[model samples]
Target chain A: MSLSLNQWTTRRWSVAEAVDGCVRHGLQAVGLWRQNVAEQGLAESVKLVREAGLRVSSLCRGGFLTTGSAESLDDNRRAVDEAAELEAACLVLVVGGLPGVTPGEPLGSFSRDLGGARERVAESLAVLAPYAGERGVKLAIEPLHPMYCADRAVVSTLGQALDIAERLPAEQVGVVVDTFHVWWDPQVFEQIARAGERVFSYQVCDYLHPLPADVLLGRGMMGDGVIDFAPITRAVLAAGYAGDVEVEIFNADVWAADPDEVVATMKERYASVCGF
Target chain B: MSLSLNQWTTRRWSVAEAVDGCVRHGLQAVGLWRQNVAEQGLAESVKLVREAGLRVSSLCRGGFLTTGSAESLDDNRRAVDEAAELEAACLVLVVGGLPGVTPGEPLGSFSRDLGGARERVAESLAVLAPYAGERGVKLAIEPLHPMYCADRAVVSTLGQALDIAERLPAEQVGVVVDTFHVWWDPQVFEQIARAGERVFSYQVCDYLHPLPADVLLGRGMMGDGVIDFAPITRAVLAAGYAGDVEVEIFNADVWAADPDEVVATMKERYASVCGF
Candidate 1:
């Protein structure tokens, strides 16, 4: 019912400090990343959030069948296990693209077998969904911005994600509505309606710059980009998702500023722009 | 119908050189950008093409709604005028995005109001379509890669485009299906089926790199990227689009190479990959 700070928003802060900072900022919850938990030690990090009286909204850090890596499948399953251990609502996966790491320089004569990459993602998710669901964690398939389709996530359109979701039982699979990736989709509202109550979590970030190749770190803070938040919020609410609002951003400039000040500004902006 | 080399395929060539190169490579047709046409002098360029005995398959562009700039609107209309002057088959319209110069810098606010842009584009087209149609030129709504929604064209999906096309009598408006834009779309085949008979032109390009900024120049060559051209071609052919197969690529690297070599290779690759 309250806001959650996706520690990604305040990247400079340790996961512990991020949780502490969220507590300080009156964010009722927080979403932890696997690396953040690992860096701060999962137990201590969990304790830190508890001590600060915060909720772990959701745990990202899983999925990405980039190039059909079986090792990636195992790694993602571990992420599912870790998310369960963290007692998060869902494990958000930024499904992978293409096979192999070194698709190498000058995609010179490169074959963007996106269809193959997509098949691998679906296959991996099919493999992992039951595990995550069995552990009482929903798999929140966050369809990324279309710009990330080539390298980050092939799941570009929310409609496309909904199609994927309809493939899985509503109770077993769900989607995380992230404004940054989906705001541009023409069928966004209609898709959101389709996603309906299966909307497990919602994320907000603005497109600060043209989509970057290094998409993970170039995220913009809400209100700083061209995403109309109220419509998205209305759709999420209409879809019957009453989860904590998570401010998940990864902007370098936002992180470079004082973390405390960033939180204050984000809180104020969220209220001003999104009315949290 | 023979394949056309969208001069962009031999960007290194002058207008005359592109014509010479395409003719030398036995490519019977070509698409010319209005800017280059302006540089080459429209009359002289038309004469040169006539002398070369090549089909002026399509004009490279006739839209830039993103700027919302009167200047851009005027310029685009002029582009339409030029397309008409050149006696091109169609004035390819890459509808512009938000009213700004920075194409990649998606405005911090999501403009879900594509309806407005669509209206504006339609308004512009309403003015230009008559003129274009009068000149025996068709308006080809080349739905760009969705990545261009914010900066280039709000008209991303082919379905959306066909919806726009439905607004006019079918003959007045049509689509220029470029494989690179809609290749990854899950609904591409279905949409192509839906786009039947009205397809004015079809292009083929691949996506070697992830869909990111610096896009215009980053397009891959035919058969080089993961495009299922055979199926798409079958769909287009089934749709009754009997036209020149244009090879439109925007790779800076490829363009920086020898124009002669690029054309020869394109012909060979197109023949081998997609066939005639």
Candidate 2:
């Protein structure tokens, strides 16, 4: 009942299918992705989850904010609007990586200014935080694993995310403590304690070794990889976050499996590993 | 002249060949790997570099201390002996990752106790540091990138490495500032300043984007990836680290290229980007 299914764990499932899967599994909450919501039509998507008696725990990202461009800001605002419409707990932010470095191009052909990119994330968050606050929504900044620092999110640790979050209002901006990303950090427990009430969301996944060719899709189910979930879960709980613990995996193999089976396994892993 | 070539950059070259290449490039130093030295025979390796008037900048590794096995300890002791004989600046320690987790096995089947593994590293260092100091061979702990934290090195941050090193005698235990490993850290500059005299070796290479299938072989030559070198180079220099700046790369493509051309490119990049 405390477990939430991040739609990406069963990436192939539609909004209706995912909600149905959650209902069948006795899950009380679901995390929605922007693309899936748009595909199902935002109104219909919101209605589908609401009618199924499922709470929207968090929305799957709205922060590619490193560019600070009008287009990106507009997109983020729209994402915030969508999160508000679904009445999601928070808008998860996968803050964009360094600007102008596209894949398959000459490596680092553009700006390699990581500090500048990080500053831009702060700047954009400042702009979006108030808008979200007015709409009664919280923005959650998810610091990705350091491996993704170059091309994904420049925010690479929970401490760094907290640093950025602390600069803004705690009520408007906070952090997501994703197990797969922050488990390797030596200061993880300390940072989780420091996160306290700013902990808007707690997502779970495992860090698979012999990382696949596409490291992007390398996340494993809870018991399948190197993460020990109980400590992190307890830390988040101790921080006073009595929210849905979302199971968010991005493994290619997981996405190809049966949706129902994936949901079933997720429930079992969450119950066993999360220590709830 | 201050730039040194890490032997693994041209991994195909013999110890003698690497030494010759250093002499040809007007480089004053070379960072040696243990296997390469064993291949050339330790005595001959010492003679070859000595005769070429090349300073052995630092030996490429001596710690797999996470296992805390007697065999691992013995092998590390032998490595220290080699470094002392070679008169290298330090024995670079790529401390082992989590214990009992071999590749191609079940992921979390072994201990997920990162704290325990780290404590083992500290214990191994406590035993080995005195041995290294007596031999006048400094043990340089290289905090690998977080991506490698699971299977390569438990020491994933320069600050963490410093915390470990501060417990031992500064003369015996130190840290390596490898750009490829530590560039993503937010506290890099602050930690570098704190490192001061404890900075044993400075290794340079760029973090390539769209990491190759094998992330281990993903380092790019300076100026080829997403790192702004001048600031870090300046920071290390400001930290009072005047040792040879070793160009240590490990890309499969670089390995397959002409060693002469690679050396030439390394020199040019070092001169231009390193601000020497």
Candidate 3:
């Protein structure tokens, strides 16, 4: 396995630039976000990466099932199509949060219906899994940190993600083991083991507290935060997951740096900690 | 069951003032913090609450076992003694996080030896449990939010806390069901049932994101955040927790308010949602 530069790590870079940066860093793959693909035109983005001989490790995201909205489902279907078109490893699903919330929305708007929202995720997965499977695209449920449980993703644990995924076939639905989201969990390794072959993607990033005003962008570059990546990487490898290790940081400082410099830092950090 | 106004909610208020505030709000109990108790002189703090006809629901905190330091054990024993002296229901334990780590410590300083830290907590508990029981105090393990798992507490779930608690007698070691900490857990309701009579304390505080710089003080007043209190309160009650429902907000705004007003808000908030 080799390092895959997740495009969000350098938020400013275009798909074309990100693929070029991956090439420059000798990275074998690049994880593309849907937004960047859209900005460059999907077919052109696919052509650019394919022509550069860079594999699409995974697609950034495709789930917000809690809204119970038609738009969310339609958007997800389009994301699945994009993943299939790009021949990405899987379509990563953030799996939506509380139905009525927007980021920084007032407390009054919070439904506090966590279980209801979770049920919607399972229901939505039931609907989307078959579609993705038919298109030969895997839906990788990324269980984000519990801090994002309210407004970002209701699926807050890999165990919980697997519980949903196990309902569908392993090839159709799987879990993303993102170090930043799960490093705090006491049962993380156990859950990682339990995920087994259903482990679809392995994303790396570090977690730093005293988080900035936008908590979403608080992911630190690997080796810049407390996560011991060696152990987590070892666990994923032990669980029989042989895939690209995508560095998916969302820090503002990292994003502000030159794209080439960002990729260089990611490569250095990834090599130092992940041993891939 | 009635409400207990946790002293940290009105952080600036002295123990004497807090007891008076609780009384003014028609509250029968106040959860005392060790620092506040120490500031007032422990004996004097005990007398103040007793004289005001206020029961000491629980002591604020008593665990930092992750340090694997002798001082941590000594401090926890002291906390047990203090709880016993006040005849508090239980000594709330925020069982510490990773060893050799300080808040905002460099990422390199983090041991990521979570298992080792957790082992130390169990070892520390084994040492302190008998002492606490002998002193007529119950040590309540309060599993904090997972976000704090890195630098604050390794015990991040009620199931994990209960796993530790079950190793000892129920009367000697019980679990705290704090809504803010355990609400996001998918198995929380099941764990609450498993806790049964071992539920020594049930703390209530709402959770809101866009947390302040110090995430520690981000707890919102009940009814002001996203937690559905009624269900959690109901779960604890069903688990045979016939104790005070402590309102333990830690917001800077709440602390900045007049003690009387803060207590008033807590009472109103508790009554509106906690069903006590």
Listed for every candidate in order, the interface RMSD values in angstroms are 3.7, 2.2, 2.0
Candidate 2: list runs displaced more than 4 Å.
A103-109, B103-109
Assess each prediction's global lDDT (C-alpha) against the native. 0.77, 0.91, 0.87
Model 2, span A1-276: residue lDDT tens: 288999999999999999999998899999999999999999999999999999999998798888899999999999999999999999999998889866445553467888999999999999999999999899999999998987779999999999999998999999999999999899999999999999999999999988998888879999888877888888898899988989999999999999889988888887788784
TM-score of chain A of each: 0.92, 0.97, 0.97
Q: lDDT by residue for model 2 over B9-114, one digit each (tens)?
A: 9989999999999999899999999999999999999999989999999998888899789999999999999999999999999998888766445465577888
Tens digit of per-residue lDDT, candidate 3, span A64-110:
89966778889999999999999999999998778677777664455
Q: Write the per-residue lDDT of candidate 1 for residues B23-103, one digit (tens) a residue.
A: 777778888987788889999999999989888889988787643567767776677678777778887888877555257
Instruction: State each model's TM-score restricted to chain B.
Output: 0.91, 0.97, 0.96
Ranking by TM-score: 2, 3, 1
Predicted complex 3: CAPRI docking category = medium
Measured on C-alpha atoms, candidate 2 has an lDDT of 0.91
Q: Considering DockQ, which of the candidate structures 2 and 3 is the better prediction for this target?
A: 2
Q: What fraction of the reference interface contacts is present in each model, in order? A: 0.38, 0.70, 0.49
Worst 10 residues of 2 chain B by lDDT: B101-110
The pairs that clash in candidate 2 are: none
What residue runs in model 1 are displaced by over 4 Å at the alpha carbon?
A66-70, A101-113, A210-216, B66-78, B104-113, B210-213, B223-228
